[model samples]
Target chain A: MNARAEFHDPATRAHLLADKARWVREQTLAIHRRAPETRVASSLSAVELLTVLYYSGIARITPDEPLHAERDRIIISKGHGSICMYPILADCGYFPMAALETVCKPGSFLGGIPDPIIPGYETINGSLGHGLGVGSGTALALRTKGKAQRTFVLLGDGELNEGAVWEALMFAAHHQLKNLIAMVDCNGRQMLGYTDSVVNLNPLDAKFAAFGWQTHTVEDGHDVAQLLAGFEALLASDSPKPKVLIANTLKGKGVASLENAPLAHVMGVGRAEIDAILGDGAAP
Target chain B: MKTTMRDTFLATVLEEMQASPDVVLLSADFGAPAIDAIRAEFSDRFVNVGIAEQNLINLATGFALEGFRVIGYAIAPFITMRCFEQIRVSLAILSQLRPMNVTLVGVGAGFSYDVSGPTHHCIEDLAVMSALPNLSVYSLSDHTQAPLFAKHCLAKPGIKYLRFDAKPHEPVCDAGNDGLIERGFRVLNAGRDLAIVSTGYMSHVAWSLLPELRAEGIDPLLIDLVAYNCVDTAALEAELAHVPRTLLLQEAVLDRSIENTLRRMAGGKLEAMGVGDRYIFEIGSRDQIHDAAGIGRAQVLDRILQHHAALA
Candidate 1:
């Protein structure tokens, strides 16, 4: 029996991804409620993006052997903003479902930021602007070692401000690293305020295209179906250039008070608020 | 003696790359005439990261994690300080959990790029690199030091920084000094009272004053401190304790002097000399800059003789 066969077909893949996206949304919010230190709003933005990659059967990974040599590399650069991974990794059997309860607590390897100690993470990612550079190296290594594995790095839109990211972009393209893929969670808001007001990276696609990446944008990154399609096309691209998916998402996707808030990145969700959100049809 | 460190080091790397498929040499577009051959023969493994030091280190760490022995090469100052955070987070921290053989080969030591000014001069690499928890610092003066460094890269599983001089000087070492290199320091010429200790080019400076001091019947120990952070502290301390005085030397800033380091170990008083806090804008030859900084051979010789007189 195909575990993902229900969603394996193009006809149902979108629907399955949508269904999983809701569960991921609720779980991400609930996890934040349990561990108030986790970045809830920032985490919400990448929920569907992560869902599409994992459930669409596009990423070659195993929960049992998360560090398998053949597994496609995934580096989540915005570590603080990637709390959605706690639920996604747990559901994928990367760790016991119960371990999610111990996040940010004593002896829990799952801290506020993801690290290699977590079975699925490729490297230490709490420090921003490292993922792409490191991922380019992994992609180069895969090619040099003659292994057919793609390396994917997840970055925040604001993370593009880092000069190192551009350095990586140039390197990946110059080397014709076709197997390296990046998904920028363009949630508009960084820690301080809107990325536009902070360090405007307008024409993000043109910026990436100029660096020789095969650039595309998902107009509504929150829409799971669109995300699934976007990833499928980029991964299937036979073009020699490295690829980038500029996911145009909101900083805070679901909660009424948090959505589009300038300081959503640091805004914490309380248990009472979490209860109210969950009770109100869990609309995300 | 007249062999440049960059030329000789790259030659050794090229030979090692030929012997193993897993060895990779990456440059930040910083090169030697000899590196062209390695790039030509091992184009697949040799990566020119295009003058970006931060990316160079991250790429090196990435390759090392994937099981390649990577050598990240660039000018000394940029390699040690420009991407310092990357070195601290990626290479140093990562090597603690994972076994990695990643050596950073940084050229243009101290006044080697004298005409190029302070930006090119690496005067603080030793102190800064030594501060990192898991990183090893290899400061070498001559071509004879290549095999020791080669062995570290080929089999060692950790982070290493190799600081090489830009200019080629006459090899001061008389060969067959494995014990000194391995133990990290050696008494080149054992003496009493004061000990003249130095590494890299400063070792030559320390050796120069030996005959002058010996002529005066002042037999201060002439010691060459080869490797940093790889030394057996207690052993080196025991050896240095024999002399009543120890003169620490380096081409880098005064803070990187071995005397400062030894003070932290056994708590001793010592005289220190090297490049001071001020940047060199004088635009002279290496010796002239050292002379301006009051650390040239003549000044150094005067200091040693003065010490001998004080002891007498």
Candidate 2:
């Protein structure tokens, strides 16, 4: 078996990356189609990062079995990117592919954002800057209980404005939670405008370093090879601090009309746009 | 009242942790006296999260998700009002599925912390805690009730808020004879002319006044409402119906304490006797403050007698 076949044959490895990416894109379109009035956009690189972590990295998930005690935790702090999460969850076989149809359905567990009730998702975090604090707590609990389970939290660059995030950062660093890893989806653009324009978290690496975190930045977030390599590096590192992977990504990637679109972060796409982007009857 | 509520709580917590090592304690720079033994015994299990109320609640939530039973300790205001949202999201919502039993030990209510000024006073805690769904609020009437309520809270699988005055309190009820104060208990003589429903230390004052009412040929039913949030509405209504009138005696504001109970049991002609609507402008001792707020034993009896006479 070649490199791709070896990874994709059992369908556990990055073979599902394409399918995960497709699921993310289609589900985002589905959310937009369902709630025409609500603004919905996809996080292209978030899907890619999730694909790398859930597929290739340390996350212990048997597609059929989602709740494994020893399994690594993936907390999505930047919950808006859940448009991508639901599909990736489906691709990982946490739930049926048809469950993706209920993305943001009224009173449905598969809300527009990540909620713990949806099986694979760890914590309910629509409010930004809360995930890190919760992740730190989980890490502390694991450490105290003598468990080796690692927790991975994905945060948006814009969410760093919250002081609670910094409070969590300081605590995590002080406690020396080696089992906790944070990945910032530095997609730059936020709801109003670019992140730099909003809060200017440009000196991101230096900030994490000051906070006593082992920080790394991946220039190409969509590059699966680079993403996987970063995870490997984190797992191997001996640093007595939390790891932060600042994955630089495009807000709306893959789809032509939405890529780097200013409004894509918050604006909704209609049925016509969904058809125009992924083609008709593309979602299975 | 063999064991104080604080002692019972610590004992139960230690027991639970021994069975399930995931049980952890987080405090907001308080509960030193209450949890000293627990801290000494289980050093790794206890955490002093500093004076940050919001951070403490968030940290507790995170710990809960990490498979740890997190118990947060602080004064009533800091635990209930300051970190209210965190409790709602982290404990209440999550406790619906998994056992997110976060034992909040709020030290003192009303005049108990009178010297600490209005900020420290937890007059609105019962009102606030009772309003939130999926939380078990227990206002320990005395030292004995505290431990019983605490152990009950720790053993059960849900979010529980426990309020206790730091100072020594008179033990009113015998938890040993009368089972653990799970629900409200009827004290004094049953089927009295007047019913005085009280919570926390204020119940001690109401208990003291029961004999005085009896001497005047007016037997008063003294009900010690242990759990404010999960008050047995049907049971309380039945007790209320037997009496000619009901008087809610609490250290907290009359509107929140008595009004809340009245709303819950919509049948009784209830008159509230506690701290009035206005903030206490004068500074004094806990007794003086209670006297000023008409929460003293004499004042409460007078209010009950006056209300009873007016109804007649």
Error of 1 at B183 (Å): 1.6
Would you list the clashing residue pairs of candidate 1?
B1-B171
C-alpha RMSD of each candidate structure in angstroms: 10.6, 10.9
lDDT by residue for model 1 (B22-65), tens: 99988999888998899889889999999899998888877887
- Computed on C-alpha atoms, the DockQ of candidate 1 is 0.21
Q: Which digits, one per residue and each the tens of the lDDT, describe model 2 over residues A204-256?
A: 99999999999888988887667777888887999999999999888777666
Candidate 1 lDDT over A233-282, as tens digits, reads 88888899999988989877888778957999999976777788788534
TM-score of each: 0.89, 0.82
Task: Predict model 1's lDDT versus the native.
Answer: 0.83
Candidate 1, chain A: TM-score?
0.95
Evaluating just chain A, the predictions reach TM-scores of: 0.95, 0.88
- Candidate 2's C-alpha runs over 4 A off are A1-23, A34-39, A105-108, A255-263, A281-284, B1-8, B11-20, B173-177, B189-191, B211-217, B254-312
Candidate 2 lDDT, tens digit per residue, B127-225? 787766678787877766655665576667777888887566557744232633534554544647888888887887887786777788877787887
Among all windows of 10 consecutive residues in model 1 chain B, the one with the lowest summed lDDT is: B276-285
DockQ of each: 0.21, 0.17
